[model samples]
Target: MTGERTASGLALEVLQQLWLGGVRDVVLCPGSRSAPFALALDSADRSGDLRLHVRVDERSAGFLALGLSTGSRRPVAVVTTSGTAVGNLLPAVMEAHHTGRRIVVVSADRPERLRGTGANQTTVQAGIFGTFARCHDVTAGVAVDGLSSLVAQACSGAGPTQLNVQLDGDLTPPDPDPLTWWHRPDNRATAQLRQAGDVGVQPSVSVPTDGEPLPLGPRTVVVAGDDAGPAARMLAEAAGWPLVAEPTSGARIGRQALRTGRLLLTTALRDEVERVVVIGHPTLSRPVTGLISDSALEVLSVRGRSGVATDPGRVARVLDVVPRVEAPEDPTWFRRWQAADERLSQLIDSGLAAAQGDSPRASGAPDLSPLAVAAVVGAAVGAHTTLVVGSSNPVRDLDVMATPWPALEHRFVVGNRGLAGIDGMVSTAVGIALGRPRAARTIAYLGDLTFLHDTNGLMVGPSEPRPDLTLVVLNDDGGAIFSTLEQGGRRYADAFERVFATPHGTDLAALCAAHHTAYERVDDLGRLAEALAESPSGARVLEVRVSRADRRAEAAWLRQLAEQAVPGDDPSR
Candidate 1:
């Protein structure tokens, strides 16, 4: 924060600035080049000024930072060695860029002199993230004059920023007492670091205005996608429109929220949709997309993210701030949607109960039906639970089959709907669980592929901090989602299994066994509930074997049922 600085001193000043600038969490990916940052960050953590998380995987480290920052609503930094390690952070940084969260990438680099000279662990990291990060470079032994304020400046834009710190072998603190710099005064506080709630020049999430309001008279439904937050719920309630909130939107609560939102879209209600007010990223179901693609109806989208960008809709309008709408005096139309929602909810519930046999299981496990497994999981994640859903079949199954309750009453739904890719999901949820209160449970519902895909995240070092996470895996042995799509039709059945289904017969329990984590193979619905209620600590895995064969027919039957629930227009005035 002061005049001149040493190689190690620059690293210390950088860390101090990050702490002073309101970054409470920092993730370090261990490597030889970033030794100084690791030591300085450890000292900061020891002093209780900040919390440090160490991850060997740079990709996991990036996502962990993304989760920590999102959970805390504060800027988070990820430090790594140069070259590929820095490159590994691109995914999370790209996500943060679109979602608009502050994730600082601190990479150790060779001096500018050594750059482009075929150095080990050295690549063009200066602009590695490109437009995604507001980048800065700090050479070895450079004066500490502006070093402290760089992090704040990077995060000031409301997205991710990269800092390439060059260092030499004397990686330990230049000064013996890490506390010595504490008393050393500087102008850091006065410097323009991003202050809490400070709006910046970047594409900031638009706040609502008191200008001319968007009329809410036309039939409208708010589609809350991942990270949509409570804004969608507020709009739905304020305007008397049905809320089609996704699990992670945090808007799936109260009476306005339709648990059968997607199904309703597939019915006559879709034809009556005059306008669709889309909020967040509503990419979970095709019905929502089909409704939005209706050129006859007006579509509007609100933007945000979790693991992926959430702007997946064709809208007539896009709002930074949710517009206040005037509710209609007569609520006949909305009532129809609600009425259909209730009827369909009951019918689906009954259908699932009918599908599952009433007989007791001698093995004491739960039913293997995907619906039963997801339902038990829905019941298991009671209040104070953070439910992180994986993409693809698992999330879709839960959306269609799981019982609907008040938002966060059972759990706060979370997912990576930004890019919607199934990368680093297990790690991201792990980060969320670690950041939350210990009393709360963090459970993840994902398909076998999603679970196995991120199995590397479970490869944590023994000394690393572990969270209380119960991973419920629905193992169908293949991609069941394909069965519900055009690919499952007879025309493509010959190539469907090999091409779209992509079955991988690896036993999930065996994978959990190798990782030394608890594994539960559930085949009974009652036993599934019991397993979740026990609240096991650390990481655990539950595998529910399901059949992909019936998925197509079952989905068709559900659509037919929803349609029948909507009665033909009875003009009994």
Candidate 2:
């Protein structure tokens, strides 16, 4: 607890702790209050100990950290200056909290002496990211011991953590100290980690798996949501249950996946459901939401996180791990659902095929369909490829149209379903690409609005490290997703066109050119796949313009066709 150490020394120690705590990347937002951190991080970057990312906007830096941590599955640090700079990180912190990503937020602040004096660029920074992150406010009183302990605790596991460091005096590093990996008694790596007995904050909330395997009832099905991983797929296969997985869910690629699940939930089959098994965070569809929330359905979840991980209605049972539901009580349950899904899938295929027609486009330069575009993007995902899909209609499209192929061995499908607001998607994809293997290729599929929302993310400094990324922008002009909703109906068409479907006709090619990033307009599916095949060292934007007029007609027709797939209900079938 020495009182007279240089601020840089303290900053360097913090960085050391972060590095030892498994932080390989650091995102820095330049400002006066956080200058010590900036300098220390810069020095570390020069030494090649860590990769440093500099984003002028603090908000972008936070999300960049989030993406890096999520993609890397390791703690990533973000350093910001005082006042609003720290506050701006709330959105990303909240997202990390919900998504279970370990993003460490390090914010600099003025010392206690300047309290309530209205100092410039100084305000209450501590406890700013409340509830969303574990906040650590380090004063000079316990500066030595607390900082190290807090950093270790933050990096222990899931969820984001914030470190509010209020330093006094001029901030600059002392001469670079020898890298000793901190003061360890035996010079072993044990000092790098906290003791086994250290009872700090638990990384995430969990429910233990102690209950007996519940007896399977009739019409049982597995519902896999975002970040459900591969467990949901395995469970469905092992238990012989039909799996309805979202696009981001790793379970989406398997054979048991039902493409018409979301729409099916809206039909009569939803009424016949006797039991439900839920995994991951299911937030995409209203039918799934209603199913989980329904008191009539016997809902059970073996997912992590005690609260709202599955049953938002708070009635479904939550377990640490899924129970062994080998076979359903009703033998024909799986068969029924499978048959219906197969029939519906066939109908869907035929409808999309009819829409595509048997002719090649010459004047239209390739007709557009959102589902077709997403399918092409998903198909491009191969070995050493990471697919970062945006949270809009693009993700849902892939959920319906993506098939099991194109190097599925190491493929990754990602989306920001935690907040799902479509912010920082481009930057997040870049971070995801950089977080993966150096030779691995990362491609991002987002809407034009999402691309334009965080265009500043493309403003990377020339000297900074870049990601091998391909940004696929599905330009349907505006919010075509709203068109599929009730608002897109004839009654609200007038208002929907103006507000709900707010289309911004921004020239995406010109936008990429302005940023000095490579740009290309892809129409044909093969050309899109070809663009994805190339492993460029830096990021490039690939625009795919879709037709909104045809999109509306096609979606309506598909839904009409899906509604008829409920066997015995429609005589036309």
Candidate 3:
């Protein structure tokens, strides 16, 4: 490949390295400057070497990549044109960076000589991502060796990376088999290959401690956010502390901890806990935020990545410990938390039982309440299966209504908790399924709007073995969760529905057909159970249609259940 030849071929060559390195999906935002990239990826797609996804909006594209990356564990790549197109990716990239998600952004740009000379769409592409990316490469000319090594580094690294390929206009696409630059016999490859082996362990010289454990206070609380995993349970057990966990944390509401509801928030803080040990990201509700602010206590934070400063200056102590794996114990503290956990479990049980007996009201023709759908989902799936909940109402409803499984089974729950967007729910679930083994089944519970938002995530190939996955789409037509908000009255209802809900008359069966996935329209509870019991292989879509009117009734019933379960005169209360 000569300098005069467009680096399109070299770019494709680098992309092939990424594909060979286990990248199954690539999101492309088309542009003239990025035509070469787009073309090469198109070729790869046709040959079945890589799966290409096209998104008009770069912001959505970036997030789609974020979701895919989070689900896949391995880095997923993104391609875009120069200037503002690259800038559009900032929000999702920042979120991915902070949350330690793996993603690679390959932006096409003009040559350096033309950068400052009033080029059409050019900016300081190099170093634009700052410390957010693990590595940034701005390459010009055709050098297979260098580009290949960089591609491997980007693919193998823990966080996101940028490869700004500056191209000359005369360059043309090369033959299909672009050179494998990464496979060259060089020191860089050797070192990177070695570094890949040490991916999970963060080098630590000393494990910091807050002197000695202070006497446990009555109001002391421990809150776990999304991605808290097993570490949250271990922490709560070790400290014997009551845990307030979000749905995405994989901690059951009545079993491992309490849900993040208004009442729980109030009670946890009513006694005025003097200290809080926040693990993972901060995902407390607004009321809890106020409580956290008003409490006269110190906050200690622990996370795998740095720069997540949600507690402001009150984060007296910070540690770089992996959220779910590390177990730091305090026997005395563990006893207090255990008692609190028991009290919360009893309250939740009573609440669920009361809700079950409430009169089932008449919902609309397509009567499918989001809460009801959630109940069906909770009951259908097995204890061992992973549940990847989408953002918006799906996660919130699950947090409140979902009960614990009978036995202790390793179940993982994931969401885009860092920025909490619905753009990549399907893709994230797909990636997560891909990460799991053949025996493991992953179920994705998402809303209708969220399902359509990133439907492209369903694309899978023969090489990318079909995951034992089930997709449960709660087709409520729009954002039903927002209806429960304070401004849900008649006056603002229409406007909210139009702008926020953005209802789409989507033919889910057709959508599944396009992706070659099995589609099952589940209207009754029995059908849902049968489908779950069989647990089919490959990607399957189960569309559970619920009427909007029924959703409202379900919400009302839930509130009543909460009220009756926790009598104002109860001693525990």
Candidate 4:
């Protein structure tokens, strides 16, 4: 493992150090310059040293790594060649940056001397990810001599990091092989790397259990955003406050959680809120963000791992941990919210049912509406089920239609809510399923456009490890999320179809066939339920065709229902 190392030898050492630093999964994108890394990673995977995922698209590979880290709660690596291949990782890296996932990006670059020499596939690789990820440059000399320290530095971050390795001539491994460097003698690097890994990022501390409890006198509410854990619901319960939890929030499963809270916030009830306890990243709803930004309300936020607490008003009281309640508040306050939430929930249900039509379809199945699709997908989640939701409309629809499960049903829900963009969602979902093998089931609720954005994610090698995933795509033929926004105003109606909707009539079945993945089209609720109930053989797409024409109307109708159901008075005061 020592003297006069070749580029391939350096690549093996880099991988060995990465493995020692607690990286168990690697996603490799194919390229000529990265042959050394690809070969080394393949050998490592074959020898059972680490899991390897191969994707032809670097962007997909990057997000796949992010998803793996998210699912496994450990560091995952994505390797790519030099040039724009490294640039393609920026989106996923940006996502991992805000979400606090450790996705290690290893870019194989031409030797340092190749820079400014008109070399092919040679451009600036270092610092390509900007502030999203810190880059560690490694040349053949630096790698052979101080590879351990470099890897330790790369693995120390709370979020994503990069290793731009400059490989020299003879990128492929020589005779005899160098992948056994981990099994070589005097592997003191392992112990050192483990110690370095121990020095890795620690979770942000919230208010301790013994910490001073927050006053229960105010008309408080817990706003649980994406990734907000059970603490938000527990706090709401302890304080006798309503929990307004987004779908991806782990806190959305309990009785205190209000299904119609988002809509309810738009009512007169918002004026009654005196204080807000915020948890996780809440980027889903305008009402929630508006509430947080309101200068009149006192905001208390539980700190997260991203080193930055979510404080829209810039005046939030940051808690070191989830604070306890001084005492339970009077039941009257809770009852008002409960009554309003229940009434609104009923109204929402009736509205959706009517929109979906009272009479069943010719097939005796319920109508195919976006909310209906989301409702079916949400209901499918059960014990040991991992639900990965896509951003835009699917998550928002799920937030509205999904019922709050009882506590401790073991439903793990997640999404790329850091930036909340529609990029690489398919790959992210696939990574989650592959990463958590023991889950009873894995289901992803995605929009048609979102599904199309990362079709390359379905391009798994036949020999590659495949996850049993059911990807339910709500195909409305366009970006239906915009229909609910101001841009969908009557004044913009003519321009809406061409610009905002951007509908592309893609044949999803044909697309799935191209990827060699199983496909199903569920036009009714009965069929959707049946599809979800079946055992997952491998990754499959359940395309549910919804209507964008009704999106605006349904949204308006729901808002009107909320306004009517919830009285506009501050009853608590």
Best by lDDT: 4
lDDT for each residue of candidate 1 in 385-464, tens digit (9 for 90 to 100):
78888888777777766555665453567777767877778887787777675436778888888877778778777866
Please tell me which model should have the higher TM-score, number 1 or number 2: 2
Ordering by lDDT: 4, 2, 1, 3
lDDT by residue (196-302, candidate 3, tens digit) is: 67442222111334333435444456666666555555556545566767767654533436543434454433354566666666563654465455536676666
Which candidate gets the maximum TM-score versus the true structure?
Answer: 4
Candidate 3 at residue 81, lDDT? Answer: 88
TM-scores of the models, in the order given: 0.89, 0.90, 0.76, 0.93
Q: What is the C-alpha lDDT of each candidate?
A: 0.75, 0.76, 0.65, 0.84
Where model 2 places Cα greater than 4 Å from the true spot, the runs are 2-4, 174-211, 303-308, 326-331, 358-366, 404-408, 550-552, 569-573
RMSD of each: 3.8, 3.7, 5.5, 2.8
lDDT (10s digit) by residue, model 4, range 388-434:
99999999999988888889778789999999999999999999998
How many pairs of residues collide in each model? 11, 0, 15, 5
Q: Write the per-residue lDDT of candidate 2 for residues 350-411, one digit (tens) a residue.
A: 76677677644669654866787777787788766788989878887887677654224767
On TM-score, who's better, 3 or 4? 4
